[model samples]
Each structure stands twice: as C-alpha cells, then as structure tokens.
Target chain A: MLIDVTDAGDPRLVDYVGLRDAQLRRPEVSRFIAEGVKIIERAFAAGCTPRSLLLQPRWLPGLRELIDAWPDVPVYLASEALIEHVSGFHVHRGALGSFDRPQETGWDELLGGRRLIVCEDTVDHANLGAIIRVAAGLGWDGVLVSPGSADPLYRRAVKASMGSSLALPWRRMASDSDLQRLRDAGFTLVASTLAPGAVDLAGLEPPAKAALLLGTEGQGLSDAWSAAADRHVTIPMAAGVDSLNVATAAAILAYALRP
Target chain B: MLIDVTDAGDPRLVDYVGLRDAQLRRPEVSRFIAEGVKIIERAFAAGCTPRSLLLQPRWLPGLRELIDAWPDVPVYLASEALIEHVSGFHVHRGALGSFDRPQETGWDELLGGRRLIVCEDTVDHANLGAIIRVAAGLGWDGVLVSPGSADPLYRRAVKASMGSSLALPWRRMASDSDLQRLRDAGFTLVASTLAPGAVDLAGLEPPAKAALLLGTEGQGLSDAWSAAADRHVTIPMAAGVDSLNVATAAAILAYALRP
Candidate 1:
C-alpha cells in the first residue's frame, strides 16, 4: 500500500527523521535503513522483510516488483523536498527502505567457514563497510567484529559497502573469548600489524581455515590480540610511512590470503 | 616570529579561511594547506617552504624546533575556537600550515623506476590520497595522474594518504601522450578493469617495469585507455557484487603486483 505523506513530521516517517544525526540513529532499534534503490533491492534480495519504505514516487517504478511482493509492507511516498527536510540532508538517490535487521550468524556456522575477517574495535562505519565489501568481493566466507566495532547495518556502512554488507555474512562477538572459540574450531588466527617480528605478507602460506584480525585506524591490533594470534603478518612498507588505512590493509590481506 | 591574532578575519590568515569550501582552495596559487601537526611536519620534512602557519598556543612547544629553524616564516597563533571559526570547521588537531606546493616531478625522473600507479580522472581526493599511500607503503616508485585528476596536494587528499601524498613522487600527465612515454620507457601498461576477458590477477606475471592504470570510481578504465593497455588484469570477485572501492582495488593490485 502506498501512503502519500505531505507532512515532514508524520509519525510514520520517524525512522528517517534527522538521519544525518549520529545520536538519533540507533542500530538496536531492530531495524536497519537501506538507502538508494540498489541497496534497498539488495536488502530485499537478501530476504529481509521491509518494515516500511519512504521514497519519492520517481523511485516507485524501479522498486515496483519488490514492493509488489510484500503487499503488507507500507510504502510511504513523499516529495523530494520533504525527504530532505525530514532527513536533514538531501536524499540524493531518492529512496530509503527500513528493513528488519538480520540476526547474527551463529559462531559455529561462522567458524565452520574457511576464510574470515575478524575486525577488532573498527569504529569507523565506512572502514567496516569497506571491509565487508572486500571480504565478500574476494569470496571470503564471513566477517566477525568485536563488540566495540561499528554496526555493519548502519546506514553509512551499508551504503559504503555498495550493499555488499546486506548480502555478506557478518556477526558481532558476544565477548573477546570468541577468539578462543575460533581457535578451538581449528582456525588459524592471523593478526595484521605493522609491528616488527611479523612475517612478510608476501611469504605467508595461509592455512585451509584462517581468521585475519584487523584493528582500528589509530591503535592497530591491540597488544592482547596481537600476542594471541597464531601468526603476525605485515605488509612490508617503505621507510617514513607509518601504515596503510585499516580498510586498505584489509583488502590487501583478503586478496593475498584468499582460499 | 610568533604573531598573536585574535581576529578570525585577519588578512594574514587568508590562506586558512573557509578551508571547508572547495571553491576557495586554489592549488593554482602554488600554496597548499596542511592540517594537523603530523601533516605539517611531513610538509616541512619534505622540504616544502612554509608560506605561513596557524595554530593554537598549546601546539607551539611541539613545533618549536621547526619554527626556530624557519626564522623568517610568520607563525600566527590563535585560540582553538578562533582557528575553527576561520577554517569553517574544527581544526581537530589544532594546527594548519600553508606551504609552498612542490613542483611536479619530471616524467623521465618518475619513470626511471620499476613500478608506478597511473590514475585517470580520479576526482575524489580521499581515493587519490589512499592510492598514493598504498603506492608509497607498497614501495612503488611513483604515481602518475591524468590532468583531470584531483590535486594530490589538496588538504583532504594529503590527510587521507596519512601524509604520504606529500612524500610520494607524483606528477600530472600533460596529455594522453604520457601513456606513450611510459610505453616508450619499456613500462608495461596494465589496466585494472572488471571487464570480461581480463586476465585473472593471480595468474598474470607483472612485467619488470609496470604501470597500473586505475580509473574513476563510477566507471572502470575508459575504452581508449583499456584498449591501449598492454594487458588487462582483474581481481576475480564473487557473483552479485559489482566491484570493490577504487582505493581498495588499488591496494590489492599494488600488493599483488609489487616489485
């Protein structure tokens, strides 16, 4: 059902209000907002149930099939100007869909995979999203994030991943002890660091099942996580440069250690 | 010279005004602004002459030696709030330096080395910066960009490269004939693309002197460039995923084709 919304403050459009405000975007609300027609399509293709959708009529034709399939979902049509006023920013792509956030994949299923990306405290949504996109693009099995990491389902993360975050398998660890669980399942834990004594990445012989541990942008793999890994690998960099961006580093490691 | 300026509109601080506004930042003026202490230090370390400096009083102690060395260069001190007001954004690291932009390296000097990254119309400063950082960290010799590419000296690009854009040897091509120059220099032109029939990146052997061509974010390598390349290499991606981010792709290619 298409509901035409003329008022920007309509209660039904609450999910999208002030979306640019970081404080107002709560991932715990059990719903994730996918922006643009492509990402919304990916969310639907991934079998996510739409809670509702808010978009200009111009986008309705493009998403008609997806909307038609979910007859019970409310599709709110609004003017582009109203969307900008409500979201506090221009909705350049002209569409947004609120979908039920997918549940975290079970650890047992995640650990059973051959290749994985384990991010520790990667708080930047763009970096986290790019990591997911890289992992999925390179055919990696899944992603595991520490509790402190950014929500992969956050609007910015989902958009940065070009919707790959919707299609990729990802989960947050209940606790750091999850590292031990990965090891217990016979997965090799490889820590990516710039510290000395780390084996050159070019020389690494990745095992059948490997978990690459990447850390934050500022403070790389924490001392505890670096010390606990089965191996430490460093991409040999030139003199005077400190390190690569966390996401770029992840991409290199993902491709090099691909199964 | 330490000059205390309480006014945000002081003409001496013109270089630091409206930094958040792209139209006001003119690289044609032969001056580029470096934000933060670390980047400013990189600019000095790279032997870039200081036109002037602006920062809060708290950061003075750290940069005392550098300031002392450049006795004639004026250092404008201001409160953090005034600095933010003038820059039109928070000077998060509390310092900004206006430095003389260095001249582009000659093609012969850049191509004398074995490896290079060639970017075409990469308008995004962050992507260009990341590519530079990846090139430097991976020990690539230099970078070449089409005339249409973003200025590597742009504040945002310099910061994104972790200041590597300042350290790396990069030059803009005068025209498409630069490709012919690389070819004449015995540099193998390898175009990175997602097009079918491109050789699998893993199986290809990089030439002794190779130049990897990267294109804009939305479009892959242009038809002319792709056709002119000596070889086309692609990172095999999983189905359903369109492509990796340009910077992420650059990192992977740089690592894989490392000399």
Candidate 2:
C-alpha cells in the first residue's frame, strides 16, 4: 500500500522520528530503522522483512521491485525536506526502512564455526559494526557479542559496517556462561590484550577452531576472560602509545589469524 | 596572562568559536585547538606552544604547572556554559587549547626509518588519525600523507588517534616526486589495494625498509601509485564483501608487516 504523507507529525511516522536520538531509536523493540538506499537494500537482502518504508519519490523506481514483493507493506512517500524534518536530520540518502530485527543466531551454529570473534562489553556501535565488517570480510564465520555490547543493528553500527552487520552471523551472549559454552564447543579462546607477559600476536599459531576475544574500548579484556583464555596475545606497541582502537585491533588480529 | 571573558563574541575568542565546524577550524592558520584535559596536556608535552587556552576554572589547578610555564600565554577562564556557547557544543571535557601547529616533519627524517605508512588522499580525518595511531603503536617510524589527505592535526583526528598524532612523526608529501624520493631512499613501496593479481599481504616478506601506501575511503588507490609500487598487496577478503575500512586495512598491514 502506497501512502502519501504530507505532515511530518503524522502518527504513522513515529518509527522515523528523532532517528538521530540514541535513546529513542530502540533496536530491542524488534524493529530497526535502516537508513540510506544501499543499507535498506542490504537489510532486505539479508532476509529482514520491512514493516514500512518512508522515502522520496525519486527512489521509487530503484526500490520498486522490493516494494512490489511486499504489496501489503505500507510505503510512505514524502518529500526529502519533510522526511528530514520528521527524522531530525537530513535523510540525504533519501530512503528509510523500518525492518523487523532478525532473530539471534543460535549458539550451536555460531560456535560450530571455524572462526569467530567474541566481543566482551564492546559498547561503541561503530566499533562493534566495524568488527563485524572485518570479521565477515576476512571470512570469519560468526560473532558473539556480550550482553553489554552495542546492538549491531543500531543505525550507526549498520551504517559503519557498510551493511555487513545484516549479512554476517552474530548473537548476543545471554551471560558469562556463553563464554564457557564457546570453550565447550572446542574453541581455543585467544584474548587480545595489552598486558605484559602475553605472547606477541605475530608469534602465535591459532588452532583449527578459534575464537578471538576482544574487550571494551578503555579497559581491556576482563580479568576472568583473560585468565580463562587458552592463550593471551599482545600486538607490541611503540613505547608510550597505549593501544589501537578496538575495531582496528580486531581487524589486524582477524587478518593475522585467518584460517 | 589570566583573563575572564563573559561574552562569547569577544574578538579575542575568535580562535575558539565554531570549534566543531570543520570549515571554520583551520590548523593551517598557524594554530590548532586541542580539546579535553588530556589532549591539552599532550599538546604541551609534544612541545606545541600554546597561543591561548579557554577552559573552565575547575581545570586550572590540574594544569597549573603547565600554565605557569608559559606565563605570557593568555588563559581565558570561562564557565563550562560560556565555553559551550562559544564552541557550539558541550564543553564537557572542560578545556580547549589553541596551540601553534608544529612544523612539518622533514622528508629525510620521515623516510629515514625502516617502516612507514603512506596515505594517498586519505580524506577521512578519523581514519587518517587511526592509521597514525596504529602505525605508531605498532612501532612504525613515521607517516607520509599525499597532498589531498586530511590534516592529522584536526581535533577529531587527533582525538581519534588517542593523541598519538601529537607524538608520531608525519609529513605531507609535496608532490608525487616525494613517493619517488622514498623509492630512491631504498624504501619498498607496498600499495594496499583490492586489485586482482596483487600478492596476498601475508605472502610478502617485507623488505628491511618498507612503506605501506593506503588510499581514500571509496577508491582503494590511485593508478599512478598502484603502478609505481614495488609490490602490490591485498588482505584477502571473502567474496561479495567490498573492502575493509582504510584504517582497519592499515592496522592489519602494519601489524603483519611490522619490522
């Protein structure tokens, strides 16, 4: 169903309001707003069903087939200015899709993979997204993010990943027991840390099935995860420099340890 | 020289106005603004002479010694609200410093080292900064940026690098001849690209002196640079994934090829 929305305050456009406000954009509500034409297309490509779409008419021809596929879905047409007004920022890419958030990847499927990235409390959405992109790009099979980690489906995260978050396999760990579950599935947990006495990353030979564990931005891997790791690795740094950005570090590690 | 300015429009406060506006913030005007307490301290530690400082009174005692060292420099004290009003953003970090932009690193000095990162038109300040941070952290000696690259001294870039931009040695290339100069100076130019037939990054044994060249966000590298490289290298990726973020790619290359 195609609906023309002239009023920015339309009640049906609530899903698109204040898109830039982090607190208002909730991915946990079983929905996420996919911004930009490319990202919206990626969401659909990833098999995410769109609840609705708000877009300028200029984008209609390009997205016509996708819209036709979901004839029952409401496609709200509006001018660029009105959509910008409704979203609290310029929707410069000219389209937005409200997607039903995909279900979490099952633990058995995630852990059954040969390569995995396990993020512990990685709170920055961009960082989490970048991690996902690199992990997927380097052929890592899946990602396991701790409960406190930022939602990969968040707009910024999705945008930063260049929509890889939609295509990659990932799940949020319910608790610390998830770490044990990974170990029980034959993963050799390798913690990326800055702690002294850890073997240099370049020297280590990863196992056939391995999970690279990364921690939050400031404080590194938790003491429990660090101690529990089958091995600890550090990327040697020039004196006085603290560390690389968490995602940058993940990319380097993923590339170095790729199976 | 201690000063208290109540008005945000004070002509003396021009350097601090519109701090968040990229077009308005020009480090090329012989000065750069350093935000937050730690970055300000790092600026001073890196020997950047302070022209002036706009900061909350609460931060004065913490920076007393450094401020005292440059008694001739104006220290403009303002409430956080006033500073935020002038800068057009929350001055939550409680301080900002206008410092003399340091002199460019000499070509001979930048190329003298064995390991280097050369960025060609790397326009994203944060990516450029992260590349610098990783290069420095991984013990790479210096960075060489093409004329079109973003300024490493940009506030966001400096902040993104965790202030490593201050301490790392970097210089802008004067021309394409500058790259030729590196080759003449016994450096192997390794271009990071997604082009076919490129040697996998892991397969190459980096020469004693190596320069890893990275390009802009969308495009991998320029034709001239790619053709001129002694070796073309790639971090192999899964099919269907376009590319890794340039900074992330740089981190992986820097770590893998660290001398």
DockQ scores for all the models shown?
A: 0.89, 0.89
Best by lDDT: 1
Candidate 2, A151-176: lDDT as tens digits: 88888898889888888999988887
lDDT of 1 by residue, A163-225 (tens): 888888889888888899889999999999989899999899988899999989979998999
| Candidate 1 similarity to native, TM-score | 0.96
Q: Name the top TM-score candidate.
A: 1
Q: How high is the lDDT of residue B65 in model 2?
A: 97
Candidate 2 TM-score, true structure as reference: 0.95
Docking verdict class for candidate 1: high
lDDT of 1 at A80: 90
Residue A258, candidate 1: C-alpha displacement in angstroms: 0.1
TM-score of chain B of 2: 0.94
